[model samples]
Target: MPELIAPEAHRHAAWLQAHREWGPGAHEDGFGLLHDDEVDSPDGFAAWVARLRSSSGPDRCTYRWIIEGEQVLGGIALRHSYSELVREAGHIGYGIRPSARRRGVATWALGRMLDEARAAGLARVLIVCAAENAASARTIECQGGVLEEIRATEFGPARRYWIDLDTR
Candidate 1:
């Protein structure tokens, strides 16, 4: 089976260091629209680390995606109860290294998380993405996500999709 391991905390420093595509200050280049402009320093990454480790934080379950023993992707997560905010800000977030896109890594990683959610007693899931992001929308739909509603927001309009795991 393909493995989807949560990243080790000890590796965040190194992982952030090795990744430029989604690293600090990356949003300036259009690669990270979700990241705000202030998160561009080592201190910023450190703060991010702390947030991910906090049980109360939506970024708490954040993980790095690895394949064949190599870290090739990044993911940020929130509990199912946080669907409203998640559908607007962060439902399921992932970024495959530039060299790794289109290789099925994102789809596989998301599936693993969905399974995790199911085991945690979540009956349904809401996954949202930029309406224009066909790739992301495809990934969610492939996992049985059905279009629910679209919301207009300050950042941009988002498409909200639902996946009823109980029915699956």
Candidate 2:
């Protein structure tokens, strides 16, 4: 079974394998990777992991990797606070490695993150995906997401949905 685990340096090799599957880019959403993050070197990767571990405060984000044994299947992030960035990007972001798509990885990981949100005392969470991302929309819907709108953002038009934790 796949489980969410904190980012650890020991998994650098496995994480790199999964990162390669996404090709070159900062598009691996849930890993909390920034554009300037240099994860290629062991020292740089450890620094990146430390940054993730040290995240705190009102705008804190919790990142978890979807792993089954030693293999990384994907990742998910639960934003613990509200902010302008959260308003646009939503409270949670996730991405499954291409090779792991079509399975229930995203849905399962999302459900787990919802639990985290609830524990953080959030009444609801905003999840946004590119309007054309039918797969992500469906995963959100499966978890009882209600569409709020499709709005324009810097990234493009995105479908916004709210999952009411009280109803979950």
Candidate 3:
């Protein structure tokens, strides 16, 4: 079974490999915000994770690896709270490994992330995705997400959905 594990130094190689799969800049699609130029080694990546964990910023969140054993299939970030940016961005963000795409990894990871959200006392959670992302829209719907609105943001047109943990 795939589980979400806390970010650790040892998984750096797999994480880097996934980043390289997406090429440069593309990995910024929710794959660790740490710049590749700054993280030359696993230790450096660990330091970066530590910094994010310690920050008092809007991006502050607990990022975890979506793993089945040692392989890093992807990652999911569960934010502690919603900031102005997070309200727009979301309480959670996820990225799937190139090799693991289209096989239900994202859907499963999201289901698990909702468990985390509920545990954090969030009665309902907001999730947003690009309007053009059909797969993401499907995933959110499968998880009982209700369409809230289509809003324009700096990122582009986005679909915002709300999932009620208490009801479903």
Best by lDDT: 2
Candidate 3 to truth, TM: 0.89
Off by over 4 Å in 3: 35-37, 52-60
Q: What is candidate 2's local distance difference test score?
A: 0.95
lDDT of 1: 0.61
Q: How would you encode candidate 3's per-residue C-alpha lDDT over 1-168 as one tens digit per residue?
A: 788887777677877777777677645444457544455576677887676456555455767778887778888877767778568977777888778889898999999889988987888888888899889899889999999999999989999999999998
Pull out the clashing pairs in model 2.
Answer: none
RMSD of each: 4.3, 0.7, 2.2
Q: lDDT tens string, model 2, 95-155?
A: 9999999999999999999999999899999999999999999999999999999999988
TM-score per model over all chains? 0.73, 0.98, 0.89
Q: Give lDDT: candidate 2, residue 150.
A: 98
lDDT minimum window of 10 residues, candidate 3: 28-37
Say which prediction, candidate 2 or candidate 3, comes out ahead on TM-score: 2
Best by TM-score: 2
